[model samples]
Target: MRLRDHVVVVTGASGGIGRATAEAFAREGCAVVLAARREEALEATARECGKHRGARTLVVPTDTTDAEAVEHLARRAVEEFGGIHVWVNNAAVNAFGRFEDVPLEDFRRVLDVNVMGYVHGARAALRVMREQGRGTLIDVSSVVGAVTQPYSHPYGMSKHAVQALGSSLRQQLYVEGVKGIHVCTVMPATIDTPHFQNAANFTGRKVVAMPPVYSPERVARAVVKLVRHPRREVVVGPAGRALVRQSRTAPAVAERVMARQTEKTHLSRKEEAPATHGAVHVPIAGEGSVHGGWGGRRRTGMRRAAVAAALAGAAVAAGRRTGRGAPGC
Candidate 1:
């Protein structure tokens, strides 16, 4: 769909990937609706979006866990912009701790925000799209949706559920002969976002993204691309794709590697963080930005090399399985 003047609604727009996505769509001249529990942050995002191509922006403070709030968000978007062309569900929260150490309430909160939130958004968007007979819905999942990670049990579970939700919804739409309504899932690798800082921490350590973190803008670009050419799923970074492929081919090996890597690097013992519920139960007040501080420290060159090697290995394996020689051989 042409982005110019199209109405796009993005959840979790207070910060991180959602904020970047809102700005990206705005650059394409789309009228954007920014929704999150944080009113101030949503307003801040609205201001930034407005600066792009003179795009019109609406700030709707929505807690996606609440079905009514999410429904209201969709209603407001259409009330203000005529119709919903695209809807991006990106709201999420995480808690870092061992499965046994984390509180059950926190685990449920993660599911409520990450899984139920998407469900609410999808339902609302689908209703509008079914009526209009056309629209796009993008669900921002994660690589962990395919491969489980240590110290983030709840998060991994929620993402996995999101993947299932998207697939099921797509199949339902197809069975019903719905057309022009596309459901796309975007699974990104570790992103340099404030997600770690905002997560509910019980590990008694500072949370950090593993090395080779991709920038939020990278994922945002993928979301924008999906607006025009929707696909079933798109993994944003090479590291993410590699991990997903590895998990599928060698689940035991992948599990061991992730367990060790996460334990060693995903948490920092030097910095101390008190246990807090974060935004799981309440909204945070602040104007959040796109890039988290981790970007400057990323090991880009090494990551690129690793990705290239993984791709080459996959190609060779494919050739062998098909009883074919390498290209030019």
Candidate 2:
């Protein structure tokens, strides 16, 4: 569990949470392997990681959807670093639109990258980890996986599948009596990452993360912690935790609230963006960064107020129901 000199492979290392996580591991003195479809970006991330003394890095341009490519990525990590201690599956894509409005091909592409990509990475990592007798596999899911959202049906569906996939893998591992191999899922709230901009758009409006956006570094920190302390799942950010709690406690209310909030704030009609498939089928060329420039827009007060109002409303409703059943006193 100690990270110093440990070999870690991180998929989707070119940008967003993946890039920040690679840097985090490097700071822990781990030999990091950066995997993504963007060779130049991956190399850039590798250079950043190399800045840390005693930390080595390998850049592997990989399309996770390709089973062979993912396998090769794993082999290269073992061949270079001698072994893999932690594998992080963070590669994913999204399409924005109503379920019917989104093209079928685009929807399939989302599944291929978000769901199948994680599967391929897990399979390859498990093969190496089982041989090594100890390794941690981390899959980056989302709060949407637990609670549904509007205008992002494919993404939500894929994340749900990711949660199920991790659970199933863990169960099988337990049955096989596999020791030292751990599967963990990290579900984050709306993160201030390039995802909104990179996602394929069909809504015509500019996409934006909802209020109370958490920095990608927050999720990156969580991922690094999981390296040493593996758990079944970890939800990043207070907003995400609140949403998950609400979903579990009041499914109908949560769904209705989320539907309204998503439609109102998730997309902006002021700005215009043309529809594009994004990186679903091809690599986006750039040396991506960790932050998505939404820091100034974070509405922490608004988020806190919303949570308080919801709690108060729930309490009032419960009081009303109790009063209705109580006899005159």
Candidate 3:
């Protein structure tokens, strides 16, 4: 589990959480293999990683939706690094729209990239791990995986599948007596990443990273920790952890709250957006970085606190109106 000279393969390493995760492993002295559809951006990420610890990196231009390409990616990583110690399935895409409003093609593309992509990574990584008898596979899922949102059904469903995938993998590995191999899932809240900017949209309104947006680097750190001490799952953001707990205890209330919150917060009421497939079928070309220009980490905690207080006040006000409690309550 030591990171020194550890061989880690990170998919979706072009930007966002994947980029941050790769950098984190690099800083730990791991030899990093970066995979994404964009080769130039992967190179950019590799350069950034090399700046830390002069980490060794290999850039693999991979389209995760293509099973053959993903298999080749695994092969190339092993060839360069000798073996895979950790494989992080971080490649994913989103399409924001009402279920029926989303083009069937776009929805299918999202599913293929998000769900089948992980499947391919898991299959390839496990093939090598089973031979070596030790490895950790990390899947970057989302809070929406546990709690569904109004729009972005394909994304939510795909993430939910990721959650199940990890769980099923762990259970099977345990019973099968597969020692030293672990499957871990990390579910993060809304993260400040180019994910929103690159998402396909058909909602007629611009997509926004809802408030309480945690930095993608935060999720990256959680991933690094999981590599040290693997767990079945971990929710990265405070808001995300709370929402998952709420969904587990009060499913109906969580669903209703998510429906209302997503409508009010996830889409810009003022900004208009024309339908376009963003990075679903084709990769977006640009210099990519870890942050999405969202504000710093200090603001995230403040916003989460403010939102929680407002929601609590609203509940109290409704209670008084319904004559169910004292006026103060």
Candidate 4:
């Protein structure tokens, strides 16, 4: 379905890819409903979307993990912009550490927000879309869903579940012959988001080691493209997409490489200094700096360019290794 005249609801709209995606849809002339826990941030995103000229936007401070809140978000979007045409499940959290070292509560929180949050949005959107007989459901999964690393068990598990959820939902849709309704999963590499810093970590360090980091806008743009044309899955970046291909071609080799990488990667759980209110910094942007500057075309363009460059570099290195009949020399 075209975004120009459709209504879209985006969870985790306060920052990162969600914020970028809301603006993207608005630029496409889609009326957008932005939802997240932070009201002020959501308002800021809404204002940015409003600046885009073609789209009308609404902000709903919503915690997507809350079923009631998600239901309300869906209802409000319909009330304000007619029926919902697309729903993007982008809310997620991370907790890095050995499974035993990570607290049970922390694991639960991540699962609730990352896994169950998708479920909540999917359930709510499916209800309205099925009634309307048309809709698109977009899920932001991760490369971890396909190949996991050490110390990221909770996050990986959540992503894997989300992938399964998307797969199952798509199959169910086909069985029901739900014309015009689509579900898709987007798996990306380590995004340059604050997930590393703000995510609950048992190691107490900042930023785990991931060779290439893509910007949130890279994934955000993919979401926009997917909404325009739904697919079963879209893996963002050449490196990430290639890894999925490699996994299918040589599962054992991919597994060994990932296991070695995970073993060598650093795991930091160091807690940031609490603010005056005793709240830790929420890692929505990224550790150390926000790559794309605030919200803008130039910054977004630069971020995507950087990620594309990294992807190209990785691909060249991988190709060289393959030519040499070695994984890496």
Candidate 5:
């Protein structure tokens, strides 16, 4: 689809994939509406968007957890721009801890933003889209949504909910014969984002992005592609695709490898971290960006990630060889 003059709304525009996606739409000459809790960070994103020729952005400071605020965000986008051609429900938060150890409030907070935030955005955007007779709703889910992870209990659950949200919405739209409204989900693997550093960490160990971390721009490219040709779901990175495929074919091996990975590489073994609610209840101001800069010996780390990936691959290969997962390859 030609998207040069499309109007796009992107939540969580303060940083990470959301910021990258917003900038991408701006580059496409789309009127981008930036929404997040941090006004300063939103302004920063707006400035970056404005750098592109024909890029116009509106900074709407919105806490996606707030239903009313999200509604206002959609209205603002419609008011400033002509209409909402695409809405990116990308706002999210994470809490790192065992299912029981993590505080109940933090868990709920994660759901409020990650799941319910999409609910609000979908409702508001769909209302406008139904009226306009065309629009796209993009939900940013995770690879963990397809394959579960340890310690990030709430995060995994919330992403699973996001995946469900998109599916259910699409089915309902079909039932209602809503021809022009489209709901799509984007599942990205670990990327170079600040989510790891800002998560509510209670594991007493520093959280890391592990390895095989692609740049946020990679995910941005995926989102932009979706705008051109909407799909039911899109997995961004090769590792993410492998994990999803492994989980489907060799479920047992996928679970074992994922548990081992989250237990080992996902958290720092030597560095001690204090228990704190990182960004669950508050926003990190003046420090938001597209990249997290949480780098280790990435080449070595990726070698380790490659090993884990090979394990998953080997399991699938073994399953095919043994005729366990399927009749044949």
Candidate 6:
């Protein structure tokens, strides 16, 4: 469970949870391999990892949606690090729009990265881990995996599939007598990451917003726990935790309430000019730029973030209680 000296491979390491988790593991003395589609970003994240002395780091630019590329990522990790002990499947994308409005290509893309990305990572890591006799596959799922969301059906579907696959894989490992290898899922609510901003906005509404968002470091801290002691699943943030609890205790009521709340909300309306579907904007809000200030200034950032997180958590809880979503800001 000690990460010191362990070899860890993190997908989607360019930013958000991946970057934070990579740095966190590095600080614990783990040899880290950071992977992402952007070579520059991956390299930069690896450099951050290097700041933690004694922890060697490598940058492998990879497109998780591609099976061949993912295979290369695994081979490179083993070739360089000797072996892989922990593989964090954290790469994903989202498109915000009604099912009818979202393009089929977008749906396929989301599934490929979110669902198949985990499949590929788990397959590659499981092979190495099974041979090593001990390893862990940590998946970064979302709160939507367990609940419903408006204007983000594609993302929600992909995450739900991930949750299902994670559970099935865990059982498969048990059945195969793979004792040391563990498959776990991290289901979090809206964390303050670039994911939401990068989310394709086709909802015909501008100004994307969420009531509350948890800091990426909170998620990083949770991943650290999984590295130390793997669990079947862990929900981040109070809202996320409460929703999971509510889902279990009142599945019908929860679904009905969530359905109603989503119906009342509007998603992103950002549109690209004709012939250009690609966007250069930061994928999500608070991405790239650090919130609050530098170094220890996280204190101020955390204070503000805590309030938002509380509001988000309360909103979800209140929605469940009242079966209605409050008006958007």
The C-alpha stretches of model 5 lying farther than 4 A from their native spots are: 295-329
Count of clashes in candidate 3: 0
Which scores better on lDDT, 2 or 3? 3
Per residue, candidate 5 scores C-alpha lDDT tens digits across 128-186 of 99989999999999999998899998889999999999999999999998888889999
In model 6, what is the error at residue 267, expressed in angstroms?
Answer: 3.3
TM-score of 6: 0.82
Q: Summarize candidate 3's per-residue lDDT along 1-329 as a digit string, tens digits.
A: 56887899999999999999999999998999999999999999999999987589999999988889989998998899899999999999999999899999999999999999999999999999998999999999999999999889999999999999999999999999998999999999989899999999999999998877898878999999998898889999888899999999999999998999899999999999999899889999976888887763767767778999999999999877788555564
| Candidate 2 residue-wise lDDT at 103 | 93
- Per-residue lDDT of 1-329 in model 6, one digit per residue for the tens? 56797999999887878888888899999999988777777777877888887999988878787788888999999999899998999988777766888788877787788888889988888889988999888999988899877777877898999899899998898888778888889997766565555566666554233534567788888988987878999998776788778888998877876666555433433533222123222232222421212222254367778889999999989778775454442
Candidate 2: worst-modelled 10 consecutive residues by lDDT: 295-304
- Across 1-329, the per-residue lDDT of candidate 4 in tens digits comes to 45699899998787767887788889888999988777777888888888877889988988877899999999999999889999999978777667788777777788888998999999999999999998889999988899877777878899999999999999898898887899999998766654554566565455453645667777888988887788899998677887888888998888788877765554433533221211022434321222333233454467679989999999999998788896465
Candidate 5 overall Cα lDDT vs. reference?
0.90
- lDDT score of residue 63 within candidate 4: 81
When 5 and 6 are scored with TM-score, the better candidate is 5
Tens digit of lDDT per residue, candidate 1, span 1-329?
56797899999999999999999999999999999988899989998998977599999998899999999999999999999999999999999987898899999999999999999999999999989999999999998899888888999999999999999999999998888899999999889888988899888888888866888888999999998889999998887888889999998988887888888889995888888887778766688877778872255656778889999999998879777554555
lDDT accuracy of residue 319 in candidate 5 = 78
lDDT of 2 by residue, 1-329 (tens): 56897999999999999999999999999999999999888988988999998899999889998999999999999999999999999999999988888999999999999999999999999999988899999999999999989899999999999999999999999999988899999999999888888888898888988867887888988999987788999999887899899999999988998898898889985888788887777777788877788772255456668889999999999999999899683
Off by over 4 Å in 4: 263-329
Return whichever of 4 and 6 wins on TM-score: 6
Q: Please report how far candidate 6 places residue 68 from its true position, in Å.
A: 1.5
Between candidates 4 and 5, which one is better according to lDDT?
5
Write down the TM-score of every candidate: 0.90, 0.89, 0.91, 0.82, 0.89, 0.82
**How does model 6 fare in lDDT?**
0.77
Which scores better on TM-score, 3 or 6? 3
RMSD of each: 5.5, 6.5, 6.3, 7.3, 7.1, 8.9
